[model samples]
Target: MILTTHILSGAALGANIPNPYAVAGLSIVLHFLQDTLPHGDYLNKKSRLREFWKVAVDLAIGLSLVTAIVFYKNWLSDEVFLTNISTGIFFSLFPDFTTFLYRYLNMKFLRPIKDFHEGLHCYENGSRRREFRIENGFWDIFITLASLLFLLFLCAG
Candidate 1:
């Protein structure tokens, strides 16, 4: 799934859950659960710069939306809200961050974590190449839309 979808989902969890520890744990669980769905990823991209730019833009947009939502909900003054939401967002992205470190930085110590994360991915024909194709990423697009709608519902509720 795109990082934005993950962020939105995590933000939803944050907005609802009162406990930061619960938010963190559930966000990480949700991140892995979402990854178990068929989705696109930049893992196999050839150009590091291009992949970085894509992730940077995705993160920027996701964070912006989350900030807007937090502001709209008037949670800025609430320390607990900030902590919970930040924990949700951090844990949701933690898996991908570790994977990036293992892949790009050649962090050998994270090999076990990287392997475990890859093992959970739902790939077609055991091929990572298909993950970059637009046609194969319909689920990602759909989930992204669904997440946005969910957030809208939360805001209105």
Candidate 2:
């Protein structure tokens, strides 16, 4: 799943769940759950620079989309709202961020977590084994739209 979808889903979970600890724990779980689903990732292991640029662009757009949604829903005005949503977003992206660090910095302590994350990925074998096609961007839009709609429902409720 795209980071944007994770962020939105985490935010929705946070909004619905009042307990901070539960939100944090469930956000991380949701991150892994989403990754286990068929999704498209644009990262390429052969080209470091190209992969970096692609990931940078994806993160930028994802953050922008989250910010827009927060502002649109008037979530910025409430302190509790800010805390929960930010916490959710942080935990949701924490796995991916740590995996990136482990890959580049070769952190021994993070190796376990990285290995666990890779183990849960649906595309672990490669895109050929992936049920979804990256070329068409179908899963990307499908997941994003579904997440956005769910977020809206959570916010409205």
Question: What TM-score, over all chains together, does every model reach?
Answer: 0.84, 0.84
Full-model lDDT for every candidate: 0.77, 0.74
* RMSD per model, one decimal: 2.6, 2.5
Q: Encode model 2's per-residue lDDT on 61-114: one tens digit a residue.
A: 777877888878877777787788778888888898887787776687998998
Residue 121 local lDDT, model 2: 71
Residue ranges of candidate 2 with Cα displaced over 4 Å? 44-50, 130-139
lDDT of 1 by residue, 25-105 (tens): 999999888888777676452546455888888899999988887777677888877787788788899988898888788
Q: What is residue 121's positional error in candidate 2, in angstroms?
A: 2.1
C-alpha lDDT (0 to 100) for residue 115 of candidate 1 = 81
Error of 1 at 149 (Å): 3.0
Error of 1 at 46 (Å): 4.8
